[model samples]
Target: MNLTPESKVLIQGFCEFISGTHVAQMQAYGTNLVAGVNPGCGGQELHGLPVFDLVEEVIEQFGVIDTTIICVDPYDVLDAALEAIASHISQIIIITAGVPPLDMVQLLRKAEACETLVIGPNSPGIIVPGKILLGTQPSEFYTPGVVGIVSRSSTLTYEVAYELTKAGLGQSISVSIGSDAIVGSSFLQWLQILDEDETTEAIVLVGQPGGGSEEAAARYIAEAIDKPVIAYIAGRQAPPGKSWRQTGTLATVIGRDPNFGTAQSKLAALKEAEVPVAERPSQIPELLRKEIKIN
Candidate 1:
């Protein structure tokens, strides 16, 4: 929470030649990248940050790593995250996509056991504009404000943030909390965080068809959340019992298909809970203005 210009960050899979431009970009944007981890690539530097062969080596050198961003391959994501956790890294943000669900499940279990917060295996990551960049979220699409945005889709999180920023309804934090069915965290967790965040005056939830997360969020909003929750569940037109790029079909595939997470069912739950639902991303700002009297 105490994000500073010098917050210590360690890149788990920092490459020298291939990823120099990216690490430099992050450094340019005020990301305090202290070190990187790449087996057999130690004693080297990328973007001026030292590279370590393992997370333990980085820990031994740097003392304490505040946050670690996992950039390893999907198959290696679990091991990378585990290494980070072993090094007592409190917060991990996994940017690697396409990690097997079972692997994520195992990783999440381990993370939970250690009381660590893991952001994503398939996520764009979290960004608080003018403050911290935990993942790869573009800062141009973000603006610091009272609205808190949480979403499942990586692309749509940016689209919604762009819409809000354009409308002058800047966001406190915009994050893609992983779109895979068996993700580390859920809307409920972020909802609670945003609820407690004093800067957040309103909440924007961008959910997609296929997971019970939306339905669960609605239930929580109805019961606990006091802030005005503007909701948008994407993929309404997605064909049922079919795939829509890992979004819509997760419920059935994961064998946790709540009758409520389907397109129609999800929308109904939100409406039933009196959460204002937007039909499209562009409509979100208008809905926010109407609901929270913003911009």
Candidate 2:
């Protein structure tokens, strides 16, 4: 999406004036935060923005909102997003964690039907370094540059960004699609965006061992992406053949069906795709330098 510093934003829950709340950080970063939505807090002010009872009310006051940051509780996340979708909000960033996968599945369906981009149900959200803060990505680790970063884990995303920053490599955009087993978006989606992004000269893909997203991304990069890609798959030390069943019991599998969802498989796929794979976060910038000329 064409999200910019000038994008009008709304919050689905109260932007409390306290630590750990994204309001102060986003506002301080110069985000165009318009208003908020909190039922029963209508006509009241929080974090210097008018609080309304509904998404439509916020829109009525602020006109068309380009994006919304859903800060409601986990259980209320689906309803909050649906309200935003019903109000025709084009993009949503969900900050709440522990949302049931079924709820996310429901949200994804409606989001797809409405053609809305949902960032996360348990995400740190998206950040364009010096431009705008759409979610809770620690802005201190980011700087405006040519490398675009996409990852499933928030903390790892931060650590990798910090490494890039220390190596004198900065990010054009950093996206944490969420660490949940089922997230709103995928690696390919953001990879496509970064591939088309004029500002992104290279991409750093931070993935973990869980699902098939990393392998899928490797295939896409091999086929579609023109920009140089550097990959780092976490959990290489994680035990293999241990799959978490719905009953919470781990079963030892035999062969690598579905690529075993292992880091080795992801690393191998990326290598087969000719994408440079970093054994650790510190190696990322070096690998990137080898792939693309960067100052």
Q: Which is the leading candidate under lDDT?
A: 2
lDDT string for model 1 (1-295, tens) is: 4456677888888522126666666777788888888898899976687888988888787788878888887788889999889988888887777778889889989999998888876787788777777767777888889999998888888899999888888888887898765778789998999999888999999888765778889899999998999988888887766546756244343555445456788898899999999988899888888887775
Tens digits of per-residue lDDT for model 2, 20-48: 45678888898899988889889888878
Taking all chains together, each candidate's TM-score versus the true structure is 0.92, 0.92
Off by over 4 Å in 2: 14-21, 242-259
Q: What's model 2's TM-score?
A: 0.92
- List runs of model 1 lying over 4 Å from the truth: 1-3, 15-21, 248-260
Which consecutive 10 residues in model 1 have the weakest lDDT in total?
A: 248-257
